[model samples]
Target: MFDYSKLITGDMPGDKIQIGDSHIKRSDTVFPILLKKVKASGKTKIVISVYGGSGVGKSEIGSLLATRFRSNGYGAYVLSGDNYPYRIPAENDRERENRFRYGGLSAIAESDGFCSDWMDIVHDAWLSGADADPELAEKYEFMRDYQEAGKTALSAFLCTPEEIDFGLVNRIIKKFKHGEKQISLKRMGRAPEELYFESVDFSSTKILIIEWTHGNNSALEGVDFPVFLYSTPEQTLEHRISRARDKGVDSPFTSIVLEIEQQKLNEQAQTASITIGKDGELIV
Candidate 1:
């Protein structure tokens, strides 16, 4: 068991982040696997990624694992994937909104037969913040296509190179694997001006672990161990609500985003080195 009182969490986790009993159990389950993987690597410095749903305890478990590594006489450090996005959280969120809204309207605009009256109704729906409601599609059949198109566009943008700076994170991994003692990591916050490079001294960091939603993304490289935390979108949303990491998490748009992200995660699960279920059990 880990000392839950003294864990070093990810760099940019939510201020309201909580470490529950389940987190401790998952870390206990994952620590030995990670240690074996690191030892088998037989390399001077190795990179690992703890990936999963947005609020599936990646930060808490990741920190606990790092603490375990240190207690076992190995050096460890945790890097956050949140800081690798191209834009700060707020700006990136607005961009996601823009992409979604554009996709919905463009689907109708590019149709062979555009309906001005239908567009008028959609305009009204947008004004009332009901454009994304499924019930709206019941009244207007065309809204179903519009909503699906919007969600598809959002899916394309989420976690892709268009949004995340996979190249930058890759370079950092390269440097770490090459035994660089000092590295400059990106730190992105919610506000526009909170972007900066943080110089981290890695002289004693033998195992560099990254805890992130897209940690197993194909775009990212040099991950010796990819540990995935599996959870349904509904479970993830419940966790997000409790964390209150950001506002508007309970919105329909946000729910759709989580669903898309979860779908992608499931698609990527086959390549994961380790998988932890929602109930803190290993998924073979």
Candidate 2:
């Protein structure tokens, strides 16, 4: 049995709003439930994903879950989704720009069944001088902006499952499942200039925990248990602002990005085995 008491903490104002001390409340509430589910699944190797939008307390809850599993005599490892990015910060900016421009165009062309030659013409028009025809110019501008907006909307989240180094994540998970004793990972940092290597000893590890906003993905096919935490945009914004204040930084853009991320993340909730609502209530 898991020690539920360790996950509890003192009451705080944020708990009422489901942000600060709520991680402890939710984790404690969910620990035994998750443990029972894992045991019932009958899987020798267990993988759990705690996923939610920004400021939804994924890392904190994931850590608490790992502790619970460890105390129960299970070897557990916690992996951060932040440590897996398609590119470093500097390179990612350029990549996003390119993906937004070219990727959107390609998607448009494919969706419309436009031949390469026709796409080339449209592409040229977009790059060439302004059109003399007002209607044509308006159409071109609308298409350009539409594509840019679509990509911008998705990129705002910074790292989606598509952007993660799933190849490495899968490899690590596979090694653990195969009973590998230790593994080294090239972990990513919050900034482009920062990156470091770390090794994990998984010799006795029976459960692997991965948490991220985009943790719900096909790449992680064999997750024994998946937990999805949900929070409204208003609550998320409040939590994000509070966190930013604590960090001594101001980020107005975070609100805009999180608004989009919240919608995307909600759609992913269906993929989870367990879901928790904004009030820290479990949703069956």
Q: Which stretches of candidate 2 lie over 4 Å from their true place?
A: 1-20, 89-162, 191-193, 245-253
lDDT of 1 by residue, 1-284 (tens): 34567666677734344778898889888888888888887898888899999989888888888888888887889999999888888889889988988899999887777788888888898787777788887887788888999999999999999999999999999999898999999877787677788888999989888999999999999998899999999999999998887888888778888989999999999999999997778896
User: With candidate 1 superimposed using the best TM-score fit, by how many Å does residue 164's alpha carbon deviate from the native?
Assistant: 0.5
Candidate 2, TM-score vs. the true structure? Answer: 0.70
Per-residue CA lDDT of model 2 for 1-284, tens digit only, reads 44545442211112212334687788877788899998898877888888887677887788788887888877777777756777764565445445555655655565654455556645565455221223443665545543545457456434555566877778877887777887886666546556777776777778888877777766655566779888888877776676662331123233435656677777777778889876669887
> Against the true structure, whose TM-score is highest?
1
RMSD to the hidden true structure, all candidates = 1.5, 8.2
